[model samples]
Target: MSDTTPRIETERLVLRVPRIEDFERYAELLADEEACRFIGGHMPRPAAWRRFLQMPGAWAVQGFAMFSVIEKSSGLWLGQLGPWQPDGWPGTEVGWALHRDAWGKGYAYEGAAAAIDWAFAHLGWTEVIHCIDADNAASQALARRLGSRVLRQSGMPAPYEHVVVDVWGQSREDWQVRRSTRA
Candidate 1:
């Protein structure tokens, strides 16, 4: 794997490392009820900061983790999106979350495509997985848009019982074909 951090740019978004300054914007999104519904529910600012500080290290240590998604034109923090390989996970987890206002704009698809592309291109990762809450229709739609196939039905970690989810994945070969066709 390349030691270099891959920077992926979509038409209107920039997927980059999260900094201390991003906490405020990120915290707000994390605390948003609608936005956080699927991702272990809402979290306080302190917990959000703690997670932010640990993400890049996760990426460096495991070769993949969620990254901050920003708007290129305004340089505004939009949300977080990336491929996370959390311990005990079966495959790379493709995840993302955007503030409520950023919804319906196709930002999720744009950011996710770039990050998934980076995962295959830089890390030689053959499969990118998207584990989303079962009821989250939007995310399920987005996973389908990325050409990810549902691999299994699974449950969320502790404190999130009763919330079953679908695990979606796409192989590198499929990703390459999808990207090529889009181009």
Candidate 2:
């Protein structure tokens, strides 16, 4: 609830503010073509450096940003997933982007659910969105699993303005109901 990034822990993962030490692994994810495809195409190391700093910068400026996901068991860097809302954003969003190696293990779902709960509870967010690429079926499926439906279609901000994405989301009331049902 504080303006600082908080460490969030789930059954199998830890979400905390990113650190400079995470740069290498984080850059690896940014540089992986397949992993970065839906988010943005892979970039060179310098670009990756800027991309890597973006999250921390967001945290500093906005007091909220993506968390560096760590596998609790192995202490591995999975990827980033949490609240994000840059200039001209469609809405407050809880997004996810895991490394290719971290896929297929339900990490995205688990981490995103936690982040959504935090956003609704601590951030006073009435609703949350996921800006998923139209062709990213995997992300679309995850959005469905998270109880979000396609609210509309919108374009991203500059540098990604050419890409049209589906805005999938649910209100806090609906999210709470879904959580209670899951419990």
**Largest lDDT belongs to which candidate?**
2
Q: What local lDDT score does residue 113 receive in model 1, on the 0 to 100 scale?
A: 89
For 73-135, candidate 2 gives per-residue lDDT tens digits of 999999999999999999999999999899999999999999999999888999999998888
* 75-160 per-residue lDDT for model 1 (tens digits): 88888888787655657777888888789999999999888878777777888899887788999999999998799887665555
> Once superposed on the true structure, which residue ranges of model 2 sit more than 4 Å away at CA?
1-4
- lDDT of each structure? 0.82, 0.93
Off by over 4 Å in 1: 1-4, 157-163
How big is the positional error of residue 84 in model 2, measured in Å on the Cα after superposition? 0.1
Sequence-dependent TM-score of model 2: 0.96
Clashes of each: 0, 0
Report how far off residue 141 is in candidate 2 (Å).
0.9
